[model samples]
Target: MAKDKTGRLHVTVKTGGKRKLSSKLWLERQLNDPYVARAKREGFRSRAAFKLMEIDDKYRLLKPGLSVVDLGAAPGGWSQIAAKRVQAVEGKGKVVAVDLLEMPEIAGVTFAQLDFLADDAPEKLVAMLGGRADVVMSDMAANTTGHRKTDQLRIIGLVEAAALFATEVLNPGGTFLAKVFQSGADAELLAQLKRDFAAVKHVKPASSRQDSSERYVLATGFRGGALR
Candidate 1:
């Protein structure tokens, strides 16, 4: 292991017959990422846990006795943070995580393997939560295809769906947070959120890689009722 001038570790990926240049570069980046190291040392499922931690630290979204719905929660990093902050492990609150893929058990989170886009997803989530949620958050991203425009559209589509779901399931005075790319198409989504929530803001947590275009849309103080 070697440390760069900035005191960050520098990892070199040796090229091999089967390894493509892109894969090698990705491996190198992950190897040197401080959050990845910290996640391993701290026992979080993924480095993404820090993104939610930073967001909640600034926004105070997670609290004891709050009901939380985690959409597209895979690998369970965000769910882990929510469960602890909301004291779900102690039975003071609830954390319901939904994803297309199965996740291993987290002490206080109830996992469901279902697509958020499905017709019955909202109702199913409400039933699992046992009522309206205090917070609905998503860290979902569409599978990238290397085409910028197509990728941006896909990202916006998912965030829009997640936002619509939040409005339906969130309680009055609740919060919604979701990841979005820095795409211009987000304007419509922002407009809709502003109408449904008292305040909406864009946040880029330090835990997120600076090179990534990812940003989180945070909407607080839900006005409640059905989507307009």
Candidate 2:
């Protein structure tokens, strides 16, 4: 009923035997989520903006005029923030966003409706960029099959693909950020990133829901020593 400075609301909802306690609580939480309201007010496509905000605030990414690619940018919340920041610099900047689902337009952003896993996806992205990018970000999560191991593998597969594509498209000193489940990143994925990037760190943003198993991996300073 009331919202505090933290954007948390003490919402009351009657379960009425229609739903489980967890389901009712989750619905109520989403309904009263201040970030949701803030996103609506700020014209963000999803509350995911806060997640990116928290990440950038901590890591100092999203510089002005930087070239960036937003993978799995269906709702375009992360792209929205990136577009604004990158547009602030001279000579213009690029924010190329792609997703399997159609996204409503956001100014200063280029949207592509295509599956990132498609065979020609990397080529299409390269054509759109006309060059390498400074940052590559992915919030892609596979449609969960409810089978823990299967879902983990699916997400890891996507993350791995995104990571490989980043290696192909990112310039020297570029950064890669992607979401991953708590099942932990695959060993080969970590090994590849460590070899290609100067540093890799895992981060959990504060805006992320406490119950969510999602975390982000930030790999920065691409070696680019072998990209040629």
Candidate 3:
């Protein structure tokens, strides 16, 4: 894979002998996906990088030298982008990336392998940063159980926990972005974000696959409301 100035990745297709239908379909899709090609070309670990980039481009959450936290950072796509931009700016910028899976090393990014739901996780993240973060972003999703309601509820739980964590850790005017579902965020969660942030909006970036129901909630301008 190689990248161009526009951050587009180009990958060469390799033909492997006969494969299962699903595998073949997946391979074909990957070969044709512009985001996947762009990611590879640009040296990003995953195609999800475009989602964060698009979101930031619209909301302007990313700033040089600002502390940022990335949750569910497996493969470190978002962290990679954040690290590159933040490191370039110098200053006090830092990125703390956490996931249950190991991520390849990236300059200027701290990786932690731990469950965010663990009681000590927030403290661990804060300790790593030495301070609150300017941005708290989460792409965490519960493993789908194939039951629609069950999956949605479990994902909502994760988002709610992430939101609560943000309430505790975000600096004033901080931003929070979390992946949600087509059903949208829970009413209570949306209400809480509205109370805590100056603006709360839901967005679906074009980079996100059309068939996927995934959406994102972007909360900005933290008000430092009651976290506990």
Global lDDT of each model?
0.91, 0.86, 0.86
lDDT of 1 by residue, 33-123 (tens): 9999999999999999999999999889999999999998989999999999999999999999999898999999999999877888888
Name the 10 consecutive residues with the lowest summed lDDT in model 2. 84-93
lDDT of the structure predicted as candidate 1: 0.91
Best by lDDT: 1
Candidates in descending lDDT order: 1, 2, 3
| Candidates by TM-score, descending order | 1, 2, 3
- Kindly give the stretch of ten consecutive residues in candidate 3 with the minimal lDDT sum: 83-92
lDDT of 3 at 65: 82
Q: lDDT, candidate 2, residue 33?
A: 75
Candidate 2, 146-186: lDDT as tens digits: 79989989999989999988987798999999999895577
33-86 in candidate 3: lDDT tens per residue? 888889999999999999998988887888888889999998889998788666
Model 2 TM-score (2 dp):
0.87
Deviation of model 3 at 98, angstroms:
0.3
- Candidate 3, which segments miss by more than 4 Å at Cα? 1-24, 88-91, 225-228
For model 3, which pairs clash? 2-41, 3-41, 8-38, 9-37, 9-38, 9-41
